[model samples]
Target: MEVKDKIVIVTGAGSGIGRATAIHFAKFGATVVVSDINTESAQKVVDEIISNKGKAIVNKCNVAKFEEVENLVNSTVNEFGKLDVIVNNAGIGPNLLRTHESRLKDWDAVIAVNQTGVFYCMKVALQQFLEQGYGNIVNIASLAGLKASPNNISYSASKFAVVGMTKSAAMEYATKNIRVNAVCPGYTESALLNQLIGAKPEMDAILKSVIPMKRYGKAEEIADAVVWLASDNTRFITGQTITLDGGTSL
Candidate 1:
């Protein structure tokens, strides 16, 4: 369970689940690279980790952009010497209306951040892993990926792509000492959801009724699963997705 001295990168480490994961890994003694588009938000977590005597740094990056992602890995290795794990946790929800009704601008934003962003992070990380001889990858997909949320075409499609990428990449490098996997969460209680609920509580209730557990998920719970996947304890496991849905997919 000890990842002491291991350098791990967490995208979207500004808030919500990403922030939680960054803090959790730092507490576990990992040298954390906290990456986010907003330096202000990311620095807050880095400040907290440093205050507690954990190793961390804030990297202002937008994963969708290749230049930023490349710089992110390079800076981490420059500062920490090597990278052992990466959490492709940066993603955006569907901000569009419907698939057909989606504006080009909205669709482009979602695809770039959610789908392409995962590819960018993994591609760079895998190259580092090849040189280092071992690596661990944890991708954040969603229950929307499995359930086909028609109303949220952009999000569902991006998450589904994440699942596909994790499995395919895992197979390609399974013998090369790289472990790739995805974590699919249900309607977790997060800042994004709170905003959504505030805008449309009635619609939220309708969606909540679909969950058997009938409640929101906490960020810490998801952090636990992500940590386990990155640890040596799950070495034999790869190309698999662990769902955190409240039996909603069942």
Candidate 2:
């Protein structure tokens, strides 16, 4: 997928799937805006991209905040003149607990960042896209969004919202040259997964055993799907969720 000269924005580009996706976009010749709440981590990614002769810039943003999300999209356009695509990769996972045992604070936290954050970013970006007459969005949802996530109610709910919003927006602007899609990664080797493994060491084996591939997916693997969905190669594909679960969901 050639995205040369395209201007792209990747939220939570400081780590994991977000980091990988930002790097991939830069490698493919997109002028990437590496956005993260952690400016330090974001700068490191920008430095690496610059060192490799790739184009990128750091834009600190807390996606949970509407003002920051607005500024993220606005600042990118202000700096780059236009935005071609946005990868809504910034999201937080929840503590593993049954619904009744789960903390309300945890649910709120997850919804704020994962669900509302995606909506905030999409809302601002859609405005810009409408003005420009064309744009693309690739939301990094989770396989949990597509199926039952037993103990992780909040995360599942937030991601499900992302999937719904993606589809709704895709159909709403289908004829307007705006494409919206989501990537649902299952048991990926991400910081979120590491946290889970840290809490329950046996989860690593348990998770892998359920997947047909019998392995945890690499962040780069998920990034590849994000890149493809954002590229012109999938120009006609929208309102879709590409699940990368190694058949675990089946």
Candidate 3:
């Protein structure tokens, strides 16, 4: 329950929510494994953690690749002897487009990272949890996964699959001491959202106008939810999706 001294792995730790979550864990005294597709970025996170007097290691990993995911898990165990929690946060948002006009390649790319990538991480973490008799997994889905987004079919569809996967995995591993859950963030302030708004500056105001809070969610706010879900306080909770969307879904 207490993340202090626990071995935690967070994918996509290079930036945004992933970076925030990694730092959050370290701040709680967890021994973190900072993994990202970019080795340089991962190392920078590692350095930051070290500078702050936290224990951490860096792993260059792309969760979309099954082999890379496997290596990430294997190396964690080899280095720390056990894994306590894993955050499946690596995902990509495709360009906005009507479903009928969407490119096959775009759809495939979104599914590969957002859907299949979560599966790969879950698969490996479940196996490790089974062996260890306990583990925690927090997946980052999206508000799009819960509600329909008119022009973003591929992104929404992939995230919807993630929400489904979270529930199914939680049911299967309930009695095994492996708790699974998802966090759906709505219009979070992150590099991913920045890129989207950069192309369509008007969306910056249009998107925020809908949220009841009248502002975008913060990465640290999402990280707080994720860390809590991973803690002992939520042990009895599983097979659930915690939506941090600033009341937009309402």
Candidate 4:
């Protein structure tokens, strides 16, 4: 992965997979913008990167808002001189309920953050890329996006939209040198997973049992794939979804 000196942005970078990806990008010598809704957590990740002799900055952004997303990209370019890559990783899960039983508010919230958020980021970044003539975008989707997620209608719908957007944008911008791709992770070990397991302890085992590997994925493992996709190593690959599910999607 040759990402040295690349200007990269990782949304939802305060913790979990986004945090790991930000750290990894910094370690690879990329100037990373750790963007998150949580300013404190984003600052902590920035501090950790700086302490490790890596360049990083904190940008508090709620991806749900287009204006905020615009500012995030504009500010990064204003500070860094150019935009190179953006990892659209900020997303929210929906309440555990069937489609008919789910609240409309939950669906709207999930779509706002998970689907529309990605669109805003991509739109703003693509504008910059069109001007610069090159860019990379890696969207963090989910196994639910590829397969059906029963009782998780909102999450599934949003992630599926992410996958669709990635492919569509890739095709639309291929001639412009803008590459777009997605990573679909399954049951990754993260704060989100912890919350789910906390709510239903038995889910941990049940989730693992369906996978051939019979285990969860680490945040760092998913980060590695994201970085590779963002790096020059995968320059020729676009509009693709890399599944990191420990065989759950098999």
Local accuracy of candidate 3 as per-residue lDDT tens digits, 74-151: 999999999999999999986888989999999999999999999999999899999999999999999999998888
Each model's C-alpha lDDT?
A: 0.90, 0.95, 0.93, 0.95
> Residue-wise lDDT of candidate 2 within 192-243, one digit each (tens)?
9999999999988889889999998999999999999999999899999999
Which pairs clash in model 3?
1-232
TM for every model, in the order presented, reads: 0.97, 0.99, 0.98, 0.99
Q: Any residue pairs clashing in model 4, and if so which? A: none
- Which has the better lDDT: candidate 2, or candidate 4? 4
Stretches off by above 4 angstroms in model 2 are none
What is candidate 1's lDDT per residue for 27-119, written digit by digit as tens?
898989999998999999999999999999888899988999999999888887889999999987766376778888877898899999999
Least lDDT summed over 10 consecutive residues: which range in candidate 1? 92-101
**What stretches of model 1 exceed 4 Å from their correct place?**
none
| TM-score of decoy 2 | 0.99
Stretch of 10 with least lDDT, candidate 3: 1-10
> In candidate 2, where is summed lDDT lowest over 10 consecutive residues?
200-209
